[model samples]
Structures are given as C-alpha cells and as structure tokens.
Target: MFSRLWPVMRKEFIHIRRDPRTLVVMFIAPLMQLILLGYAATTDVRDVPLAVFDQDRTSASRDLVEAFVASGQFAVAHYTGSDRELAALIDGGRARAGLIIPPGYAADVQGRRGAQVVFVLDGSDPSIAGSSLSAARLIGQAKSVSIQTERRGATAPLLEVRTRVWYNPDMASAVFMIPGLIGLVLQLQATLLTSSAIVRERERGTIEQLIITPIRSFELILGKILPYALVALLITLEVLILGTFWFGVPIKGDVGLLLAISCLFLLSTLSIGLLISTVANTQQEAFLLTFLTLLPSVFLSGFIYPVAAMPAALQFISGIIPLTYYLIVVRGIVIKGVDASTLLPQIGALALFGAILIVAATARFRKRLD
Candidate 1:
C-alpha cells in the first residue's frame, strides 16, 4: 500500500512543482486575498461622510455638529443651507447620514424642552445604515445627558453605561474574520487542486494506465488525496502565519490542536474534491462544481453572515457543509482559546464529516475506475 501510494504522491509533487500557476494560486493568491479582504471586509464604520443642514445657526447647533465630528464616527463633508442640498448630498452618495437642526433647537435646549433633530440615513446599504444609525443615537443620547447635567449643575451624569467587550476588545473585524478566512482559503485550494486531479488524468488519457495497473481503488484514492492534503496543510500554515504576523490576529489556543482540526477539515475538503473528480468528466465541470459548493459554504457557514440569522431551511443546509463545523472549531480555538473539551461537539462533527465524505468519495472513485 505504501509503495503504490508513494509513486502517486511523488507524481503529484512533480506536477505541482512544474506548474507555477498552481503554486501561485495555492500560495500567493490567498495571501493577496487575505490582505485585501482583511481591510475591505470590516464592519467597523468610521469617518462616515455626514451632511449637515443647520437651520438654527446657533451655538447649540454648531456644538452638535462639532460633537458628531469629535466622536470620530462622522465627518462633516458638506454643510448645506437648505434641506434640498442635504437631500442631494445623500442622494449623490456623498453622505451616508444627514443631520438637520431645526430653527428652535437652541431655544428648546435652553428652555429644557425636547429638541427634535432629524437624522436622515441613507438606507441603501443596510450594514452601513445600521452602524451610522447606532452611532447617531449614541451621540444624541450623550448630548442629551450633557444638557441635563449642565442644567442640574452636576459634575457627573445621573446614569452611565460602561461596556466591556471580551475576546475582541477593539471590536476589530479582522480579529473576527482572519480565522474564518484561513478556513475558507484552505477549502478553496484543497478542493480545487484535488477536484482537477482525476479529471486531469482522464483528460490526458492517463487514467486508463492507472486502471490497467494493480493499484487498488482505496490505495489510489488515498494516494491522490494525501499529497494535496499535505499541500493544504502547508497552505494552512502559510495563511496562519500571515493572518497572525501581518494582521496581528493572536492565536491564544494550542497550535497543535488547531493543526489537528485543520487536518480533519482537509480530509473532508479533499474527499469533496475527489467526489467532484468522479462526477465531472472535464476539468471545467470540476471547477464549476467546486465553486458551486464553495459559494454556499462561504455565505452560509457563519463566515461573513451569522448562520443563526439564516432561514431554517438554509440553516439546515449549512449544517451539512463541513466548513460550518470547521469554522466553529477554528474561531473557537483561534479567537477564544478554548480547549478540546470545550469544542468537543464541533470536533466530533468534523470527524464525522471526514469519515462520511472520504468513504463516499472512495466508493464513487472505485466505481468509476471499474
């Protein structure tokens, strides 16, 4: 078994070495994507362009505008004289939020009456709109508290809320996303590389040679998977180093545990590729099928969106995707630094997925070879 497997593994390594493009896609592409997406995929909304229409022209209104700017969440990009101009700014996408201070704002504050200020938010992008709305509300609440305190001649407010964020104190999206990105990159490279493996052999008319040989189906399947599994592990290590050193995402858990779970993840992904190989007659079909699997995995696996937020049907579907379980494990170990006992459920799920996929892939590949 070892002798037969060694030849296939060595051949795969030779093929990878000769193919520069494969090497780039496996290594360089994921690194570039990690850097680009790390910055682009942030949820922290800062410096949101704000358009202000101050009808009061009073110190109170100016102070309100200054407060928004000082919070570092909003920047006054346009100071409009009329509502039309403010609306135009938001319509043109120059401002994500608009603040309109009514003429009686100062009088309302001085007389201890409720001041009504209209905050118009561009609702085109829900995420940005939601964040801007929250910031605006917090700023408004703080300003209201300041007014009440000044009127009471007090040094401190009556009520103060202190929030303590755990695990990710800074609330940096990269800290939350980098671990998931590592899983995504691993799945993509492993599946794509192995998905095309058997198809490539068939396309080149080399599969017939293997069919005529004495290599058993399970040995051939293991042979084809092992090399790419090693490659996937190397890719995992590369991205982990980049995610930690370059993105400053700390790994607080046991490194050995992370790698062990990663190998289990690779098993499922490689098996998925082998399964694709048996079904797809051409490399293009394999690529397409791989992408079809990857899209749902990325979107529904709690990578970018929460799986709990998905509808019950989609949520049930996500349960079957190996990436979903792997992500829970990866984020648990990498971000929360939880031990194996804490993540036993996810570990068991990954182990089950690997077992099922590998067995199914072996059966399919064997049937195809016969």
Candidate 2:
C-alpha cells in the first residue's frame, strides 16, 4: 500500500513545489487573512461617534456629555445647536447615536422630578445600534445614580451589582474570533485544494495514468488526501502561531489535543473536497461547489452568528456542517481550555463526520475511475 501511495504523494509534493501560487495560497494567504480579519472582525464597539444637542446649556447637561465621552463608549463627533443638525449628523452617518438634553433637564433633576434625555440611535445596523443603545443606557443610569447620591448626601449606593467575566475577561473580540478563524481558514484551503485535485488530473489527461496504474481506488484516494492533509496541518500550525503570538490569543488547553482534533477536521474537509472533485467535471465547477457548501457553513455554523439564534431550518442545516462541530471543539480547546472528557461529544461528532465523508468520497471516486 505504501509503495503505491508513495508515488502519488511524491507527485503531489512535486506539483505543489513547482506551483508558487499553491505555495502562497497554502501558507501566505491564510496569514494575510488572519491578520486582516482579526482586526476587522471585532464586536467591541468603542468610541462610537455621537452627536449631541444640548438645549439646557447647563452644567448638568455638559456633565452628561462628558460622561458619555469619559466612559469610552462614545465620542462627541458633532455638537449641534438644534434638533435638525443632530438629525443631519445621524442621517449623514457622521454619528451612530444622538443625545438630546431637554431645556428643563437641570431644573427637572434639581426638583427631584427626574430629568429626561432623548437618545436616538441609527438603526441601520442592528448590531451597532444594539451595542450603542446598551452602552447609552448604562451611562445614563450611572450618571443618574451619581446625581441622586449627591443630592441625598450618601457616600455609598443603595444597591451595587458586581459582575465578573470568565474565560475572556477583557471581552476582546479577537480572543473570541481568532480560534474560529483558524477553523475557517483551515477548511477553506483544505477543501479548495482537494476539490481541484481530481479535476486537475482529469483536465491534464493525467486521470488516465491513474486509472491504468495497478493502484487500487482506496490507495489512490489515500495518496490524493495524505499530501494535502499535511499541507493543511502545516497551514494550521502557521495560523495557530500567528493567532497566539501575533494576536495575543492564548491557548489554554493541550496543544496536542488541539492538533489531534484538527486532524479529524482535516479528514472531513478533505473528503468533502474529493467528493466535489468527483462530481465536478471541471475545476471551475469544483470551486463553485466548494463555495456553495462553504457559504452556508460560514454563516450558519455559529462562526459569526450564533447557531441557536438561527431558525430551526437553518439550525438543522448547521448541524450537518462539519465546521460547526469543529468550531465547538476548537473554541472549547483554545478559549475555554476544556479537557478531553469535556470535548468527547464534539470529538465523536468529528470522528463520525470524517468517517462518513471519507467513505462516501472513496466510493464516488472509485465509481468514477471504473
């Protein structure tokens, strides 16, 4: 088996070495994506542009504006004299949120009637809008509490809620996103490389050579996969190093366990690609098919969006995606540092996916060869 497999594997390595573009896609592209996406794909909304219309012109109103700025959640991008100007700022996208302090805000607070301030948020992007709204509420509540305490001559608050964040204390989005990015990049490259593998052989008329050889179908499949699997593993290692040292995302679990699970993930992805190669007569078709699978995997696999939030139908689709299970495992190992026992269910799912996909891909490839 090794004797027959060695040639195919060696030939693949030779092809990869000769193709500079493949080398770049395998190594350089992932790192570039990791760096670019790591910074770009963040959920922490800080310094949101704020437009303020202070009608009161009092110390209380000025203090409210200062509070928003000092909290680091908002920056006063425009100070407007009228409601029209504030509305214009929001319409022009210069401000994500608007604060309007009514004329009697100070008097209302002083009279113990409770001041009312209007906070207008741009509802175009719900994520940004929601975050800005939450922050605004918190700032407003804190400011109101301070004013109340001062008026009552109280040194301590009547109620204080202490909160602690676990796993990701700072709540850095990169810490949450990098592990998932690792899985995404790995699946992308592995599937693309293998999806084109058999198609490339057919396009170059090399499939005939493969067909005529005494190489059994299983041996051929193993040979086609092993080399790309190694390449995928190397890419995984490179991105892991970059994600950890460059992005400062710590690996809390056993690195060996992570790599082991990564291998299982590669098995599923490679087989899916091989299956694509068998179905697609041309490289373009294979590429298209790979993306068709990838798009749903990305959006529905709880990568950027929570799977639980997806509708039942979409959630069902996510369940079949190997990336979904792999992501749970990757995030578990990388971020939460859960033990093997804790990850047994995800591990078992990956193992099952790899088994089913590889077997199906082998059958399809063998049928095509015959």
Candidate 3:
C-alpha cells in the first residue's frame, strides 16, 4: 500500500519541484498576503482628525473641547469659525469628525439643564467611526459626572461594572482576523488556483494524454494540489510566525494541536477547490465559483461578527461554512491556549468536511475525465 502511494506522491513532488514559478509562489505569495491582509484588518483606529466649531469660546466650551481631545481617539486638526468651514474640513478629507457646541452651551451646563453636543461623524469607514464614537461617549459621560458632582455637592453613584476581556484584552481585530486570513488565503489560492490549473489542462486537450496512461485519478488530483498545498501551508506558517514576532501576539496554545488543525483546514479547502475544478468547464468558472463561496464565508463565518449575534437561521447556515470552524479553532488555539482534546468537536467537524469534499471531488473528477 505504501509502495503504491509513493509513486503518485513522487510524481507530484517532481511536477512541483520542476517549476520555479510554483516554488516562488508557494513560499513568497503567502508572506506578501500576510502583510497586506494583517495591516488592513486591524481595528485599532487612532489619530482620527477632528474639526471643532466652537461658537461660544467660553471656558466651559473650551473644557468640553479639551475632553474630546484627551481621550486619545481624536486630534484637533482644525478649529473652524463657522459651519461652512467645518463642512469643508470634512468634505476635503481633513477631518473624520466635527463637533459643534451651540451658543449659550455654558449657561445650560450651569443651570443644571442637560446640553446636547452636535457630533458630525464620517460614517463611511464604520470600524474607525465606531471606535471614535465610543470614545467620544465616554468623554461626554465623564464631563457630565464632574458637573453633577460639583452642582449637587454629593458623590456620584458608586456602582460600576468591571469588564475583563480574556485572550484578546484589547479586543484588537487583528488578533482574530490574522488567523482567519491564513485560512482564507490558503482556501482561495490553493483550492481555486489549483482547480483552475487542472481545468486548464482539460480545456487545452492535454488531460486525454494523461488519462490514457497509467496515472490514476487520485494521482492527478494529488499532482494538482500538492504544490499548492505546500504554498498555502507555508503562507499559514508565515502569518503565524511573522504576526507573533512583529505584532507582539502570543501563540499561547499547544503547537502540535494547532498544526494538526491547520492541516485539516488546508486539506478541506484544497479539496473543495478540486471539487469546483471537476464541475467547472473553464478556469473562469472555477475562479468565480470560488469567490462566490468565499465572500459569504468571510461575512457569515464569525470572523468579523459574532455568531451569537446573528439570527438563529443564519447561525445554522454558518455551521456549514468551514471558515467558521477554522476561525474558532485558530482563535481558540492561538489566543486562548486551547488543546486538541478541548477542541475535539471542531477537529471532528473539519475532518468530516475534508473527507466529504475529497471523496465527492474524486468521484466527480473521475466522471469528468471519463
């Protein structure tokens, strides 16, 4: 049995080793992807440019303006004299946020009447805007507490909720996103790229020559995937190593278990790609189909959004998406220091999905070739 498999494996190794382009892509491509996706996916928004339109330059108004600046969320990029100036500051991309304190604002605070601060936010980039808004709310609440304390001559409420975030203490989006990117790059590049390569061979009429020979269908699939798998796996490793070293992220999990889970994910994704190739008549179809699957996976996989937050129907639908499980496993292992035993359900699910994909792909592939 081992001897029979060796010939097929050797044939794959040769095809991969012979192509220098494949070698470069297999190693370098993943590293490049890591840098691009990791940096872009970060949620820590800072240095938000802000324009202040203070009609009343009173001490209280200045104090309110100071509160916004002190939160480290926004920098006072411009101080505008009128609404038109503030509008231009936002329209010209000079500021992401604008604050307008109405005249008589200081009088309202002094008279114990609640004052409303008009905040104009650039809602185009929701992630950055969200962080800025949260910070602004905190600053406003702090100012309100100070005013109430001074006016009432009484201490503020003693009750406060203590919230602690484990694993991802800062709730850094990169912490969760980098690992998912590993799965995405591997799945998209290895599966779709290799799938297209196989389809290309068939479209060019070269597959008939191989089919007539002694090469088995499984061998052909292996030949198509082995090189791509190596590339995807190498990229996954690059993301893990580089992300840990450069980003100060700790891989606080069992290394062996992480590797095992990663192998399962790569195998599953590659197989799904192969399945697409078997069904597709052209490389174009394969690529489109792969992306069509990839987009929904990215959105619904709980990579950016919490699964619990989604509706029950969508959550049920999410169970079928491999990235959902892959992200959970990766985040669990990388951030939470989880082990294989603790993640048996996810491991089992990945294995089942991989098996089904490979078997289905192999069956359909043989039919297509025949």
Candidate 4:
C-alpha cells in the first residue's frame, strides 16, 4: 500500500523541487509570512497619532493635553486650531485620534462640576479606536483625581481590582498572535497549495494520463495529499521551532503531541484543498475556491476573535470549522501547558473532521478522474 503511494508522493516532491514557485510556497512563503504578519497582526496599538483642538486655550487644558502625551499611548501629531482642522486631520489619515477641549473646561473641574472631554476617533478599525478611547478615559480620570487633590487635598474613592494574569503574564499580543498565526498560516498555505494540485494536472492534460493507470482512488488521493501533508507538517514544525527559539515562545506541552494533533489539522485542511481541486477545471478556479473557503475559516476559526464573543449564529457556524478546534488545542498546549488528556474533545473533533474531509476528497477525486 505504502509502495503504491510513494510514486505519486515522489512525483509531487519532484514537482516541488523542480518548480521555484512550489519551492517558495512550500518553504520560503511561511517564513516570510511569519516575519511580515508577526509585525502586522498585533493588537497592541500604541503611539497613535493624535491631533488636539484645545478650544479652552487655558493652563488646565494644556495640563489635560500633557496627560494624554504622558500616557505614551498617543503621540501629539498635530495641534489643530479648529474642529474642522481636527476633523480634516483625522479624515486625511494624518491623525488616528482627535481631542476637543471645550472652552471653560478648566472651570468645570475646579468648580467640582463634572467636565466632559470630547474625543473624536477614527472608527474604521475597532481595535485602534477602542484602545485609544480607553487610554483617553484613563487620562481624564487621572486629571479629575489631580483636580480633586488640589481642591480637597484627598484622592477620589478607588476600587482597585487586583488582577493577576497567569500563563501569559506580560499580555504580549505577539504571544497571542503568534500561536494563532501558526494555525492561520498553516491552514491557508497548506490548503491553498494543495487546492491547485490536481487541478493543475487537469489543466496540463495529466489527469487523463492518471486515469489510464491501475492505481486505486485512495492510492491516488494519498499520493497527491501525503507529500503536501508532510510538507505542511514540516512547515508547522519549522514554524514551531523558529517561533519557540527565535521568538522565545515556550512550548510547555509535549512537542510530540502537538505535532501529532497538527498532522490531523493538516489532513483536514489539505483534504479541503484536494476536494476543491477535484471540481475546479483550472488553477485559477481552484485558487478562488480555496480562498472562498479560507476567508470564512479564518474569521470563524477563533484565531483573531473570541468564539464566546461572537453572536450565537456565528459561534454555531464556527463549531464545524476544523481550525476552531485546532486553535483551541494548540493554544491550550503551547500557552496554557495543557496536555493531550485535557484536550481530548478538541482532538476528537479534529480527528472526526479530518476523517470526513479525507473520505470526501478521496471520493470526489476518484469520481473526477473516472
């Protein structure tokens, strides 16, 4: 059985070795993605360019402006004289945030009347907006406290919630982002490359040749898939090693177990690609179908979004996405230091999904070839 599959697998490997594009996709692509996305896919937004429109033009207002700058979250990029200028700065992408300090703002704080600061934010990206807004609120509260100290010589009532974070104590977005990147990068490239595998053959009139052979459908499917599957696994391992040692991400769980589960993850994604190849007569169609499947998988897979936070309908949709379970399992093992026993449910789900995908892809592949 293994002997029969080797020829197909070898053919695929030879294609990779001979094709510069395949070599890049198989090896260089993932590393390049890691380097690029490691920088891009971060939630920690800082030094947000800010434009201040201080209508008050008072010492107190200046103090307020200084507070935001002191927080280091906002960098005062432009000081606008008017609301229109402030709006223009933001609209023109020169500023990510704008602050409006209304005239008489100092009197409200000194007189013990609650003063409000108007914050204008670019609502285009929620992450940037949310972080900047929260920082702004903190600055306002701090200023309010300072005013109270000067007026009454006492601090405001504070209910400090003592929070201790475990596992990822630093709360680095890289730590969170990188592990999820493992899944995102792997599922996408692995699926995409294989999605075009058979379709490329069809485009080149090779599938007709394949049909003339005595090889079983499963043998053909395994031949086409196993090479890519192994390649995907190696890529995953390479990323894991690079991410671990180079980036200092500790893999607290068993590396062997992680790899084992990752194989299942690859099996599913690769099969999805293989299934796409079956119906797609051209490489472009195969690529489109793969991306059509990939985009939703990324969104619903809980890589960037919390599954619990999604609406009931979207969350329900995420249930069948294999990456959802894989992410949970991988994150649990790598970050939380959970073992295989703790992740049986996810393991089972991934296995089930992989099995189903393999069977479906195989059936379609055989049908198409026949």
Candidate 5:
C-alpha cells in the first residue's frame, strides 16, 4: 500500500512543483481567500444611497437630512420633489433608502408637537435594509431627544433599551459564517481536485497509455474521481472539526443531513472539473478555466453578497450555480434547525444540477476516449 501511493503521491508532487497554478490553488488560494474576504466582505452596511424628499424645505427639515448624511451611514444621492419621484428612485434601483419629511412648515417641532418622518427602504436585500433601518431609528430617536431637551430647560426623560435576540442569540459571527465558509471550501476543493486530474495526465503524455489500458471509460472516470472525492471529504471534515471544536460553532440541527446534502453538492463541482479537464488541452488552460468558473460562482452564489441585492440578470445566473443551493441548504439546516422537508426545493435543485453535470462530464469523457 505504501509503495503504490508513494509513486502516485510523488507524481502529484512533481506536477505541483512543475505547475505554479496548482501550487497557488492548493496552498495560497484558501488562506488568501479567508483573510481577504473576512476583512473585505462585511454586513456592516454604510454609504447607502439615499433619496430625500424635503417637502417643507425648512432649515429644520434640511438639518434632519444633513444629520442622516453626517452619520456616515447614508449618502444623499437625490433630492426629489414628489413622492412619485422618490418612489421611482428606489424602484429603479438607484437608491437603497428614501426619506420623506412631511410639510408642516417646521412649526410642529416649535409647537412641541412631535412630527413624523417616513422612512422607505427597498426591501430586496435584508442585510443592507437591516443596517439602514437601524441608522434611521437611531437618528430619529436622537432628534426627538434633542428637540425635547431644547424645549424643556435641558431636562430629558431616561430611556432604556431591552434587547432580545433569537436564533444565534450569542451573536457569534462564527456560527453565521462557518457554514457558508464550508460551502465555499467544498466548491473550491472539489472543482480544483477534478479539474486538473485529466488535464495533468494529458500534459504528462499519459493519455495514450490510459486509452490503451483494458479499462472502460466508466471505470477510468470513477477511479480518477474517487480519490479526489475522498480528498475533498477529508478537507470538509477538517473544516467541520475546526469550526465546531476551535470556533465553537454549534450544530443545532441534523449533522447527518448536513453531510449527506454536502456530498450531493460536491457532485456538481466535481463534474464541472471533469468537464473542464476534458476540454482543456494544457494545465495552464485548465487552471485558468477553473479560476474563471470559481470566481463567478463565489460572487454570485450568495456566499458574500445577498442574491436578492443583485440585479435580475445576476440573480438568474446565480440560480444555476450549485454552491447557491448548497449554501441555503447548509445554512438553513445548521443555523435555523430546518428539517429536510423544509429544504426540499434546494435539495431538488442540487440533485438536478449534480445529475446534469455528471451526465455531461461522462458523455464528454467517453467522446475523448473514442
């Protein structure tokens, strides 16, 4: 057993040393991605595009609008005259939030009658909307307190806030992040594993011998896939263990279901790699193609950005990426404690993607053999 794997392992090492792309994918990419995205991609929504409709146009109203901009959470993108125009800005995707100051000639505040300001948020993206809504509330409350202070000889009422959080009450960022990270890692590993397998063989001029061997196409493909699949599984288990033991991410739901569905997700990624290997002639070409696929899959997969926030075109593109369904499934099961029945739609989607890609890869592999 040692002798057999030693040669195979030695050959893989030679390939890795010879190919810079493989080395980057295997080692540099994972750590670099964790650090880069951990810092860059965040839910702390700021610099949100805001449309203001100051009907009264008084100093008071303008001051309120300025307060929003000064918070650094909102940037005034448009000053609209009519409610219709303000609505259009948000509807047309030009702005993420809209503010309306009712016309009272600024007398209401002076008369000590608290006025109401309407905040309209585009509800497409929940994450951005959450931050924007919080900012709006805080600004409104602060303004109310200031107005009261000015009128009542600098005395203000005491206010206390009681917060109750559900579903991850500890607010562990790890609990929210680890499942998605696992999905990302699985996709990267599975795709890179299978993507280079055949291409590397061809690059080393071993395809002729592989073709002449007394092995059917199915056998050859399975033998190639099983080893890489095992490798991907090991990486996933490592991530799970580190996440649970080191990061303290709780498994609130069915771990068995998580593992089962994860395997289904791998099928699509592995098949994508196999298809790339079948088409690509050079190891460099294979590496480039794999990265090309990997980049968009991560971006559009709702891994970092919410899919609802993306344009209609991109949302449609994301529907086809296997990682998208897997993220929903895994995150739902792990954090939300949702059952398999609740996730049937995502499960079916993953199954369909896996079936289609594996069939296509098999057909291509057979054609290459013939």
Candidate 6:
C-alpha cells in the first residue's frame, strides 16, 4: 500500500512542479485576497457627512459643534439655517446626520435646565449612519453630564454605553470572508473539477490509451489542478491588493505565517473536492456536491456571525468545519496580527483537517480505481 501510494504522490508532485501558473496560485493567492478584503470591508465608521442648524450660535452650541468634529465621527460638511435646509442636505446625499440646536440652548444647559438637541439621521444605509449617530450621542451625553455637574455641584447622571458598529471591527467580517473565498474558489475549481478529469478520460475511452502507456492517475490529477489553482491564487492576490490599496486596510500581520496557513486551508478544501469527484458520476453531480459542502462551510462556518454568538450545539458543530478554523487563523493573522505560537489551536485544527481530508480522498481514489 505504502509503495503504491508513494509512486502516485510523487507523480502528482512532479506534475504540480512543472506547472508555473499553478505554482503561482499555490503561493500567491492568499496575499492578494488579504489586500482586497482588508480595505473594502471595514467595520470602523468615520467621516460621516453632517449638517448643523445652530439656532442660538452661543458658546455652548459652538462647543458642541467642536465636539462633533473632534470625535472623528462626523465632518461638518454642510451648514443650514433652517430645518428644511437640513432635510435638503440629507435628501441630496450631502449629509448623513443633522443637528438642530434649540433656541436658548446655552442658557438652558447652564441653568441646570435640560435642553434638547434634535438629531436627524438618515435611516437609509443605517449601518453606517447608525454608527455615526451612536458616536454623536455619546459625545452629547458627555457634554450634558459636564454641564449638569458644573451647575448642581455633584449629581451627575449615570453613563450607559451602547456600542454600535458600521463595517466590522470585531467581526472583522472581511478578514474572515475573503480568505475563505480564496479556499472556496480555488478548491472547488481545482479539486472536484480535476477529480473528474481522469475519470472523464476513462469514460471517453482515452484514459486506457494513457494507462497502457507510462502515465498515472496522480499525474492526471496534478495536470488538472495546477492551472486552476494558479487562477485561484491570482484571484487571491487581486483581493488582497484591492483590500489594502483601494480600501486603506493595514497589513500589520506576519505575511509568511498567513501564507503558510492559507496553504493548509487550500489543501483541505481541495482534498474534499477531490473526494467528491471520486464519488460523483458526472461534472454536474460533482458541482452540486461541492455546493452542498460549500454552503455548510460558508453559512455554518461562522463566516458572517460569531461562533460564540451561536447556540452551544451549533458552535460545537462548527468546530468540525475546516473553514471555521481557517477563518480564525486568517483573520487573526491579518487583523489582530497574531503569531503562529499564539494561533496554535487554529493551526493545529487545520493540520488535522488536512490530514483527514487527504487520507479520505486517497482512500476514495484507490477504491474508485479498483
């Protein structure tokens, strides 16, 4: 068994070594994805366009305006004299938030009297605008507290923080997603598609011609995956560059470690694809099966939501999905800049997944041939 497997593995390696494009994909794909996703997909909300209507134009109103600017949450992009003007600014997409300081605003605040600041937010695209609202409200509440403390000499209202996000600071949703997409596109395209490559030849009566000669299944698998893998890798690079340059995402992590982990992830996904190919009767079947597996890897893998946020049962189920661990590894390396030593669990899980996939694929391939 060992002897037969070595020959096949060696042939596969040789075929892969000879393909330049596939080599590039195997090596360069992850980097590109990191760049694209990092920049395009962000959780941090900043520079929201704002319209202000200051009725009093007093020192307090001025101070409040300054606070909005300094908070880095809003840019005073427009100023309006009336409520209608504020509405117009928002309607024209010139502003996301509007502030209306009521009459006697400064006097009411200073006299330990409560004053109201009307804030109008564009509920359309609430994710971004909502974040701006939360930040602005926090700042306003802080100012109100200061005013009350100054007048009353000590009874300040309790502060309650309600945090909201725009893109993905904690979810790092882009970081988690892009890397997984790399695995998905490459593995399905390369593995399952290639799995049928040799079998299709057999179905077409050409495989026997090669089989009677010197060629092997391993060589065929290599030839099939190499070109597709390269394409996948190039896509990865495109994603990374776009994320970094176009979006201004910081690549403050270890590139080398990221690449290493990506390789493992690719290997596992590819193996599963290969395993599917062995069982599938046609390309359509293989495609369907790949999608069946892919859906679970995606929706169930905690790509869009937190595993911890999921029920305990679902979280446990997600533990077995290879992409789930890979998501953690890639996001951790890219966003948090975690090193290999610290990411041991994720790395270990990937390694184990790869081994299992490879073993299962090899077994299926042997049985299919038999």
Score each candidate by Cα lDDT: 0.77, 0.77, 0.72, 0.73, 0.76, 0.65
The per-residue C-alpha lDDT of model 4 at residue 36 equals: 33
lDDT of 3 by residue, 1-370 (tens): 9999999999999977876544554465456445434433455656679899898789989988887778877889999999888866664445767888888888877766666777777543345556776787677778888778778853542111122223554656677667767777777787787778888988999988878888787887888788888787788889899889887677888766777788898888888888777667667667766766676576667676545345556668779988888876887677667667667778889999989888887888882354
lDDT (C-alpha) at residue 96 in model 6: 64
Query: Residues 46-156, candidate 4, lDDT per residue (tens digit)?
Result: 678989988889998898888888898888999999988886666444677788888787777666665677777764334555677678777776767767767875444
Clashing pairs in 2: none
The top-ranked prediction according to TM-score is 5
Per-model TM against the reference: 0.60, 0.60, 0.58, 0.58, 0.61, 0.53
lDDT by residue for model 5 over 1-370, one digit each (tens)? 9988899999988977887755555675576466445543456666789998889899988988888899998999999999889866664446778888888837777765557778887644456666777788888778778777777853443221122233455455667678888899888778877878788888887888888888888888888888887788787778888988998876777888988898898889889999988867677768767876777677778777766556566668888889988987777766656678767778999999999999999888872442
Instruction: Give per-residue lDDT, candidate 1, residue 284.
Output: 70
Q: Write one digit per residue (lDDT tens) for candidate 2, span 1-370.
A: 9999999999999977876544544465456445434433445667878888899999988988999899987999988999888766654445767888888878877777677788887643344556777788788779878887778954433222122233565557777678888789989999999989889988998889888888888998889889999998888889889999999989988888989999999999999999888777678667767766677677767687655345566668778989988887787778767677767778898999999999888878772443
Clashes (N, CA, C under 3 Å) per candidate:
0, 0, 0, 0, 0, 14
Give the number of colliding residue pairs in candidate 1.
0
- Stretches > 4 Å off in candidate 6: 1-154, 157-180, 214-227, 367-370
Off by over 4 Å in 4: 1-161, 367-370
Better-scoring candidate (lDDT), 3 or 6: 3
Candidate 3: worst 10 consecutive residues by lDDT? Answer: 157-166
Sequence-dependent TM-score of model 5: 0.61
